[model samples]
Target: MNSFFSQPTLQLAQSLIGMELVHESKEGITSGIIVETEAYMGPEDRAAHSYGGRRTKRTEVMFDQPGSIYMYFIYGMHVCFNIVSGPPGKPEAVLIRALEPVSGIALMEKRRYSSWKRSPAQARKIMHLTSGPGKLCQAMGLGLELYGSKMNKGPVFLKENKKIPASMIEAGPRINVHYAGEAAEYPWRFWLRGSPYVSKS
Candidate 1:
């Protein structure tokens, strides 16, 4: 609830639908069009890591500036990325749920599948490239190494591409937060309508 955010977490999530998230990595650059996002309101939303003002080493970056990269390991094997939101002292973030590959797709395939050399049929099934958080992180070479870093000052950066009109966006409850009590029903997830690259719906 401050000026540094530019807008609320929910609004920011919706606005990111058409923006490009680019990664300059050792293999090469890979970029994607953000097609789905979910916002976790600071301290109050049960689904948020900072809910009830809980703060720890891993959750610290969520209290930083709006553009800090918040990456965390989950399910023992996957990494999920989030953009810290809300102003300093207020912990909130927007989770990038899914992306649509836009550039360096071969390199993305290399990173994710360890082989860009795919059969003609394999190449056509590109929806799995960046359709989910963990999948996109692997495709873009994002990991825990970039945790707590500034998005605009490192290998990862986001840029505006084009605006997705309001009519093309949809909102719904976030994925996999069924244990968050009544908060599970909060319609905080936003995604481009009819985007096949979205993880769900």
Candidate 2:
């Protein structure tokens, strides 16, 4: 599966849409089909954490081989998951922005909600379970412990799924990266059309 990510940053980001992300744990198994993604062009792109060749303990994993997990904490709270992309030392990565919950809905709701108690009608809003990057990470039991894990094998990994057609994919500028100046205008974000699970439309 590592080879799956060995492509150009933008290409890999678009390709990830519709693939399945699965997690296994003592609690249960949780899975989702990826529906949205954003690419960080690295080095030259001001939006990238590895921009300007900034290498720290945290950013080091982005320089690893393709398919390495690059999880990070943001806003002093939320955890965002990224998959290392491109060749070794390139530092490019694809941010998994949203997912459509596919399996273990109950376990996901338990993890997402404080009380794990909800009416059947209220529970129907399953799209909210894994609708965003941080939410999906929490629902799937992913955290710093899974950082740097190989995506090809682990409690957390990507699985093959039905291919998404090019026509169904929508591309636009990345979200919440206004600080990137001109780079913020780059159309690196991709998502499935009409997917309620997308982090943003």
RMSD of each: 3.0, 2.3
Model 1, residue 24: distance off in Å is 0.7
By TM-score, the best candidate is 2
lDDT digits (tens) for residues 1-201 of candidate 2: 456889888999989999999999899999999999999988999999999989999999999988999999999878999999979999999998999989988899878785545654454478788888899998887898878988858888778899899999999999999999999999999999999889854
Which residue pairs in model 1 clash with each other?
none
In order, candidate lDDTs are 0.87, 0.89
TM-score of every candidate? 0.92, 0.94
User: Cα lDDT for residue 170, model 2?
Assistant: 96
Per-residue alpha-carbon lDDT of model 1 for 1-201, expressed as tens digits?
224345678888887889999999887899999999999997889988899999999899998999889999999989999998877888989999899999999887777776445653454468998999999998888999999988778899887788789999999999999889999999999999999999954
Q: Which regions of candidate 1 are displaced past 4 Å?
A: 1-5, 115-124
Span of 10 residues, lowest total lDDT, candidate 1 = 115-124
Best model per lDDT? 2
